[model samples]
Target: MKPNIYVVPRWSGTIHSDWYDWLAEQVEARWQVPLRRLEMPHWQTPRVEEALAFLSEQVPGLDEGTFFIGHSVGCQSILRFLHQKLTPESTSPNVGGLLFVAGWLEVDEPWDTVEPWLDRGTLDLRSVRERVLHKRVLISDNDPFTSDFARNKYLWETRLGADVTLYSGQRHFNQKTAPEVLSALREMVEPAN
Candidate 1:
């Protein structure tokens, strides 16, 4: 069976799945893999625990064919979900891959709304790395959220074993069309060389 692509959006993200319509359509038209964009509850003031629970409920089970793509805080929530929630067990299935865009481990700029999710003590990158088969992290050079690109790159690549891709001016990537992202998703869903 073709892998299912699950897109988790940024914090305070809307329920409107149209944001990912372009990428979703491209992937579906080419590979026939369906895309399901999850709407985070209480998007105005998001709580990591709540988002995690919601995602857990939405995706009851994951397999080797389940692929995840998360942006910004959505990336943080997804990583935590995989590490803290989906513990290694005989019954739990391994995930195919994970794609994180503008994902950050620590917040340089303090914001009260996002403080709960910034507690890195609660996240276990090692466990997350173990649960997934392949991983990719994307960051832009001028991304406001991630001021220190080197640190972000080192964290995901050196520590978590993800293939990191850097872009020049793609700030936050909140647009409907991202060719690089679309291409990456296409390659990931396709059979490996």
Candidate 2:
């Protein structure tokens, strides 16, 4: 059976209509797999908490072949979830791999859209940096969020040890402007089995 693919967008509840949805559909149709776009509740203080909670519930009783694709803040949420599980000494069976697109792991990133999440004591990036995982990050060389402070380039390199694939001109890899991400995602999922 094909693995379940979950795509987590940057913010919860705000669906920006563009190439992102189209790319996700392409993956489902071409790969013959179940794909879910897990939206965050909203860009608020509780947004990450809610997204993580919703994601945790969905993982129960899952098969051993689910994969996650996260963008921007969504990528950080994925790392948070994995850390929580590891801390508990529990294991998630369904998660097979990850496709983390341009993401900011640093709290001081200069975007107001993500400012509400900053200063939260729960976001421990250093731990995520060192913990090894079987996944990859689709690093955007020109992502604006990758400023020295936000340091996406460093995060992808040191923390993720990512199989970084370069795309020439995309900022943060958001909704409207980016490459056909589904194609890269399919490549990650299909060959693993």
TM-score of 2: 0.75
- Per residue, candidate 1 scores C-alpha lDDT tens digits across 97-155 of 88888888776696998888874655557766887887888898888987888888887
Can you give the TM-score per candidate against the true fold?
0.91, 0.75
Q: What is the lDDT of residue 193 in candidate 1?
A: 86
List residue ranges in candidate 2 displaced over 4 A.
12-16, 44-46, 61-64, 107-133, 148-151, 175-180
lDDT of 2 by residue, 23-111 (tens): 66676678776567765665443365776797788655333366677777777777777666644344534346678877556643456
Task: Name every residue pair that clashes in candidate 1.
Answer: none
Residue-pair clashes per prediction, in order, are: 0, 1
Model 2, residue 114: distance off in Å is 3.2
The 10-residue segment with the lowest total lDDT in model 2: 125-134
Poorest lDDT segment (10 consecutive residues) of candidate 1: 11-20
* Root-mean-square deviation (CA) per prediction: 1.8, 3.8
